[model samples]
Target: MRSRWGKARRVSTLEGPAFMNELQRAVASMGPRVLLFLTEEKTVNTVSELRASLPVSVLIRLPEHQRLMELMHKQGFQELAEAMAAPVPRTVRLQSSQDLPLVRGLNYPCVLKPSEKNYEYGARFKKAYKVGSAHEVDALYRKIEPVLADMVVQEWIEGADGDIYFCLQYIGGQGEVVSSFSGRKIRSWPPRIGGTASCTAAWEHAQELSDTTASFFRQVGFTGMGSMEYKRDARDGLFYMVEPTVGRTDFQEEVATVNGCNIPLAAYCHEMGQALPAMSPVSPQRVWRDEQADRWSREVSGEAVNAAALTGFPVVDAQWRWHDPLPWLDDISRRAADRIKSKFHK
Candidate 1:
């Protein structure tokens, strides 16, 4: 799909019965010069299947059936942060469902999220829940037993959407911070008490988060794409580290593509030791606004939206691509129509 700017070209979707088959097509579609890095909530045999297809890198957040939340605190990610003198949240790992009772003695309304390689979508499968009281925690654990063992309970910081931060990190071959971009999330859904962003803006803050994150990336000898998320405390005004994702943060590659810097393309070029193409720095304050007015209208009662927060900007909203949405809409619409038909027939 081509955007109005005509610079961004959407690729065809690849769905396959086998992970290797999918990888083959992905590599072919992208061409031999491109690099593909694979990361997934669950293991896809894509890495091993496409080992020879092209130069590919794979990072695993968690192994199959391994409790992901438990690995976060134990993994060297936080230790690497401390060694780099980065500010990270005070986290306590739970060994059992019984450990949740200890949180009551600590702080109220603590943030509870999986430390593993999980995202918003995975919450449904794990039945991820956040609560204020000890009772709620216990009840949630009881409701979703084995999965809670890997989760973490940390003190929650209060802040508006502006407090959330995501940085696209690129490390050079010699483990130097080549470039990084900071973006502020404007709005989100599951309403996670945050959902996804309705809009995001390029931003700047104290170098604390950046400096520390660079140090850790350098220490890890990381040579590819990573996104670091943080939340600034409303009370003390300190930025607490949330997660340093090893892979591409969702929407990041697309955002970079639209704005002019293509990290994936850069990564492929860099891996080949080729001089990267001259990249034009995107103007500060680039906006990514969701245009799903119909969805928003369902909540509000009119076509005109009262979204003063996201009014004027060069934005990419949740508008569908007519070129590719047909397959997806067909499946959904067919299911809905079948359900209606069955109800009427009965």
Candidate 2:
């Protein structure tokens, strides 16, 4: 397979043109069969360019909800939800800000999201914001006027905490789940009470989580590596199925691979209907820390690129990296400068 850069044009906090150029050089020399696209920092147009260059498989996280559903229809993803028998949040499409009050009767702490973003790629919501009256709802609408025009208001499940429990599966062309891994999220940064995790562990607990995820994949007949997330119900101890993240969990890929499960390479073989290696019995107890450590070295500091060579703790194969390093580095830098400021205060 030929390797071409995906999403090379868009610029972000990371993976800009300069970064994409670096990625292209690194992958070009390595000779990958496909480009594993990260849509957050790049555009879907980049994927189009790559597929033009080689036989490729591309999966992207959509930045809006409507786009996600549309892509689901195109990529056979919607069928999975239908098959899983999963109950989804009640969604009302908004033509403009006018639709807010009509939907607000459902009331207080509802989820506001774009009708689509290909799939959960860019679903944003102010979870737990109470709107006891229409007045509060209107306030929110006015506050969110800039982005709310294109978004929707949906019935929010009181139990949904967004501590997503993820099930990673290697699926065959026949839609059978060949192997799987379970993980639980602990903390997150965006501080969006229900945002992405700051840390997670490959721990196993609920079997229903696996069964539900498996059924969803079987229905879609997905023939590649995929992940599904569930929001845990703290009271009943069950998870509400959120969405199926098709093809690779940017960070979980490392967790699974390091814990003796190689979903990336395994999914490729499964897609071709080739014989797959047995799933290794990797202990779920394994813990992986991000390789980059931020501190005041008093020396010219830079983020570490090579996580593979970091010694001491058990590092999962190809899973550990400084994918999001700058923000953390900035915090450390500020704290270090504060220490200097303290001495001067004396």
Candidate 3:
């Protein structure tokens, strides 16, 4: 991303209200033309007001919704799915310790998740817990009930990491698809219990998955970058909706760029009312890997990179690049400092 823009960039660590103030000042200093891709809940929620106050041409990722960003919550996506008659797993939401019994009726090996990430509960279970039985769910709830007010328990979708497919779309405000991409996970850290470790472009199923995503957003009147993860059930050969990442790009967004679709660029062009870039052929065989996370998964779970993902294909790493050395270098420097500090403590 840095290489495309040259050295002119304004990076900030300030968040919430403070970040909004900085953003206002930044637009004033940088002039009217601005393209924003945001993840912060506070900044996203309040940007429409800021735009209305100033004569600035601002393009943001999410729709102007005044809400904090959360993940795997009891509300939002699940409700949307059910209302629209979409494919979703039966879920048991735990608002308090009293709701623990609600999960007992679920099928064994259910997936347990903290409703939101704004709590200490995420520190222990980074993604979710696949409990093998009712007893295990009860034991885990004893520890989680004290930390979080809400949680989710759903019947486990039977599939390996490779069965996980995702569709990312840049939906225009007037209900048009500006750009879209479809891909699948080859592996995940924590062996299906955590975040993506590696993934590749799903060439064969791209059209179908892409259409499914575009239709989803169109029906809901969503206008922004939206992504939906679907897991293909091995037992039934059906795809179940996992979750929707609304208002921003997916974490593995660059995978689309590597595969010949630059979603960010397309969205920016559309916002500026410019001609769309000529879409090119994707590197269908390329795999994108979070190298560090893959290594961690290997160390902790004896997980190996799928041979299908590597054989006769290029593996694009998450950070390292010849032109963009700073990001990779910074990662190395930070890890080295941490190692030295640990040695001194020992």
Best by TM-score: 3
lDDT of 2: 0.49
In order, the Cα lDDT scores of the candidates are: 0.54, 0.49, 0.75
* Residue 243 in candidate 2, Cα distance off native in Å: 2.8
Off by over 4 Å in 2: 1-84, 115-135, 159-163, 198-206, 268-278, 281-284, 287-346
- If ranked by lDDT, best first, what sequence of candidates would result? 3, 1, 2
For 1-346, candidate 2 gives per-residue lDDT tens digits of 1113223343333333445454455455545354354433133333323333323232322223333333333122333354446645444555566776577556456555444342232344453243455566567666655644555555555552235577877665456677777765433222223333323344555366667777765654454556776667555665766556554344545565666667666655654457876667454334343322211111113324222232223343222236645545666677799999999999
Q: Pairs clashing in candidate 1?
A: 188-195, 188-196, 189-195, 189-196, 191-194, 289-317, 290-317, 291-317, 291-318
Poorest lDDT segment (10 consecutive residues) of candidate 1: 62-71
TM-score of 3: 0.89
Report the Cα lDDT for candidate 1. Answer: 0.54
Candidate achieving higher lDDT, 1 or 2? 1
Clash pairs of candidate 3?
none
RMSD of 2: 9.3
Tens-digit per-residue lDDT, 167-219, candidate 3: 98898878799998888987788778777887888888989898887887776
Give the lDDT of residue 337 in candidate 3.
100
